[model samples]
Target: MNNDIPKAVALRYDRELEDAPRVIAQGKGDIAKRIIELAIENGIPIHENPGLVDILMDLEYYSEIPEELYQIVAKVLILVYEIDKKYTSNFNNFLEQKGGANT
Candidate 1:
């Protein structure tokens, strides 16, 4: 087996939360779902093979994650999920503020 990770794998590691919106929006399902799907499609093996939903849920709540020799992938996913959640929260707050202003 080739020990070297593919270019795509390295690229995924380099992603930051700031890029979440565009990347997530480009996928087929919800942000997290689409991310995992894309990873699998690209042949980045997530060891333990847990379902995508479970992985997403863990990232959302615990903020703690499993250990892996190649942890950069998981870190990237967590960062994106956090950015997505924060954006959603901020948007909701903005709507609430606007509603109060009109009243």
Candidate 2:
């Protein structure tokens, strides 16, 4: 409830299974801390968009992100994709150099 405390929201989208991204989880303060920890532990990309987070915090859990936010959320998804792509490439290169995987 404290404005100074950090806020975080987790989104899940499946283009084939769903129409738009949904707010899978959201919290502030200590709960926010836990959400971030789990995301990092699982290698999920964390995008820092405080203004967007603020707007998203108002949405109900499991609700699709509003249509008005489509453009902004799309940009975030693009960034996440880029980050995952780069990380995957680097990891594959590492495996190749180590003579491990068939990549």
Cα-based lDDT for every prediction: 0.43, 0.94
RMSD of candidate 2 to true structure, Å: 2.6
Name the TM-score of candidate 1.
0.34
Tell me which residue pairs clash in candidate 2.
Answer: none
Question: Which residue pairs does candidate 1 place in steric collision?
Answer: none
For 1-103, candidate 1 gives per-residue lDDT tens digits of 3323221211223335432212111222355455557767865543322233233333323232334323544555567667767777998999999999999
| Top model number, TM-score | 2
Worst lDDT run of 10 residues, candidate 2, spans 94-103
Stretches of candidate 1 exceeding 4 Å from the true structure: 1-70
What tens-digit string does per-residue lDDT give for candidate 2 at 10-98? 99989999999999999999999999999999999899999999999999999999999999999999999899899989998987888
